[model samples]
Target chain A: MSAPAQERPHLLRIGDLARATGKSSRAIHLYEELGLLQPATRSSGGFRLYEPGAVERMRWIDLLHGLGFSLQEMRGVLENWWSSEQGPAAMEELRVLFQRKLEETRESIRRHRDLERELMEGLAYLETCRACATPAAPVKGCVHCTQDHGMKEEPALVAGIMTSPEPGHRSGRGSFVRVEDIG
Target chain B: MSAPAQERPHLLRIGDLARATGKSSRAIHLYEELGLLQPATRSSGGFRLYEPGAVERMRWIDLLHGLGFSLQEMRGVLENWWSSEQGPAAMEELRVLFQRKLEETRESIRRHRDLERELMEGLAYLETCRACATPAAPVKGCVHCTQDHGMKEEPALVAGIMTSPEPGHRSGRGSFVRVEDIG
Candidate 1:
């Protein structure tokens, strides 16, 4: 009785674990092969069996993966968990991972937003130009005039906002702008 | 004289143009192929000759490309400028493009910031855990408890982020803490 309890702590078949975790059986096998996860016991026919608690650990691994942690990183974290007595260090590591993921997500959202804005502006400009056949007269003495605007100084509001190139091309002299210099 | 001015525009050889733009000849040729730029004239021997103004246009193209506009997108913007007589429409399109680029830059910055945050958090968590050998008491409640306090509730975010599976496994069920009824 003692041997059976030790070998099989609520033994679970591979299929049962896969369904509970929403992972394919093939993936489960692969994880086992990788040594990331191990089964608690083997059946008479040589089927893998897991303890009920394995599901929780698997979920944690999945969450970390989703947050963009590499397998190596995950291993490092897991090793930390396994080797060290459970304490503040493990919790702290988990927190750090969370913070990194949050930052990445925010950045992605910001980039998409920028793209959307550019498309809108381009479309709007096209529509306006279509309506007006003539180039707007170069505004005289206007700080924003493309010709008068120098790279040295910019209005505070427009600083780091946008970059505009010189009005016309001059042969032999290439006029190029750096996108980063723009706002 | 007028015909010559229109025909050649004081053509500069490709080498000189490349020197002026601080770009490699290969890159210049690639740009030409992409239709982001062109030489104003061709030599009798089929050499490319750039007019004085070609350099500036190339510079602008380079800048826009760095700003994340694809070659095709740059071409569209340039076409509006070169072909359209209506200045207003062209200006409008430019405005739109600028707006879009700005947003994209912003987003990139944001993601980087988020990543930084997450990394720091992970590092801190690791440090704390390392320093303290005791495991923090497992929080009460269901599996979702940890997730509720941590991950964001955005499906779009979930879809966009790429994650690698656990190590040593081709596939494995990912563990996640479902904080709530996040669909």
Candidate 2:
């Protein structure tokens, strides 16, 4: 009974846009409220309709979010660029921001990589304990373990758990290696 | 004059413990409140004192925190292990927990690595745009760039920025490749 979509200017309803973009309606509304998104027009029934370009706009927002920009910060980025008179100057500011973010990302990766190595070493050590023969071994005995763990030193992760209270300086026995010492 | 540290049972005051552990006094208090930590005793003036082993315990807490356990969850882990009858069973639970965390850490590393690549590719593409000759060129013209950027295809990070609203299918010009399409 109505006109074809092609003849009527192909606009997407809000639900359709949300489905296509994999964003919740509430999230789309928040983006609209934050000035990150705009509707192309309102329908005869007062429903919001979006242009096809809005899908690409959503992708832009997501990319910025993944790069650790808050919505408020993203608005600031847009406002600063649009308000500036020179395009090259605005772009240079963006370049500096991107460079700083890149450094932060690299640092994060480095820290996580260290953590990954620690975890792998910890797992390898734990695998040896799976067939632990001494069920009757006192829990405290793990601190001074004599059974060869087949490694030069205990991993920091396991050492942290087995660290026992040190004896006084007068005592002759050697102290258990603390986690910090291993590091 | 106050007695020497060695003569006074060698306990650490809260301030000394915080300094040694690199945690705030408030964070230590929270750990104590959550049953994840405990003070060995109180001074005559009501100040908290900790045993030397607390330093190693703090390291354990940091290791678990780095592995993504919430303070409450850590409390649960301790309770479960301490309450169990068998040593091997408790160690087995810990082994499983460590294995799961290793997988999660690897996955996180993969995602961050991807982000790092995207950032590098984006920075590379933007380098080509830094020396644009057409300061007078319309801002929208970037979406359909005629300049040869030396890359076979645009990176998703840059493509997301340069995407423009499409003309009708009848207009016959080739469409800009979207970020998701490249992905």
Candidate 3:
């Protein structure tokens, strides 16, 4: 007679774990080597066997890794979760790590936004050509037609943007490309 | 009588350009090789000669590079500035590059914000410990005080955060921090 349905064993091999989790076998092996994971059991043939939960564990590793956590840092967070330490101490250590990561993420976002502003300015300067019905090609072409038709507000504008402090602003610097710097 | 100070030339050599711009000589040479900069003149001895304006040009190149433009791309942009075909075509092309870069920057900022939220939630869970008049040491020290009285929001909260999108959302896929997988 077949085993009871609920008691049926749905074991997976190491290869299955890698394929199912969309990770490489090498990565799975590396995780095990790092002590971040352990095979659920070893078959009589000495092959590593895993439960369904192994896939989920791999995913958590990928998630934290994407968030910029290194393997060592992730190991620390994960190990603490199951460590005999269950409350205050565990939470405090994780809080420090999370806070530091949050700040780093914020700083990166700020830099991205600044780059965005600079690109926007470059785009705007190019837009000035909109007033020109039939513009020249670009490099030496436009200068011949427009010469210097009173369209240069670079130094002063740059200075203003540099000194101003918007909300959520930090001591970070500025970009906002110069008008003369682009097409 | 010798030439007046103002009448004296302000020509600089390669070493002088490096010192003036705070760039490595190799970098300055690379910029020249990339056509992003040019020596104002060349001495009879084959030394590179640069005008004071070369320093300003070097600064612009540095700024644009910092804004994420490749040396090759910057060369293309600067070259177009003085191109004989300067006009509608040049402006349109630069606009496209700038606009694409802008969108990419916006997307990065969005991702950063999402990460910020996730990190904030992790932090909030940690803060929950503050309510425990006496949090355990941290790692292996908290269970004795309160085994599971009311310390389970972390998993559920993390799950909720993973599933929700506050605003300005797009279908950029997802992160792998599922709730059922971690503590």
Model 2 CA deviation exceeding 4 Å by range: A1-9, A136-146, A162-183, B1-9, B136-145, B151-154, B159-183
If the candidates were sorted by their DockQ against the true structure, best first, what order would they fall in? Answer: 3, 2, 1
The candidate scoring highest on lDDT is 2
Backbone clashes, each candidate: 55, 0, 19
The lDDT for every candidate, in the order shown, is 0.52, 0.68, 0.58
Which stretches of candidate 1 lie above 4 Å from their native place?
Answer: A1-183, B1-12, B19-22, B129-166, B169-183
lDDT per residue for candidate 1 within B1-183, as digits (tens), equals 113332354667777777888988898777676666666556555566666666667666655655677867766665555554444544555666676676766766665565555455444433433334224543111112233323353222221121212233333444422222222
Residue B88 of model 1 has an lDDT of: 51
Candidate 3 TM-score versus the reference:
0.59
Deviation of model 1 at A179, angstroms: 34
Residue A25, model 2, lDDT: 85
Listed per candidate, the RMSD to the true structure in angstroms reads 13.1, 10.1, 12.5
Q: Candidate 1 vs candidate 3: which has greater lDDT?
A: 3
- How would the docking of model 3 be graded? incorrect
Model 2 chain B scores worst on lDDT over the 10 consecutive residues at B164-173
Highest TM-score: give the candidate number.
2
Candidate 3 lDDT score at position B9: 59
Candidate 2: which docking quality band?
incorrect
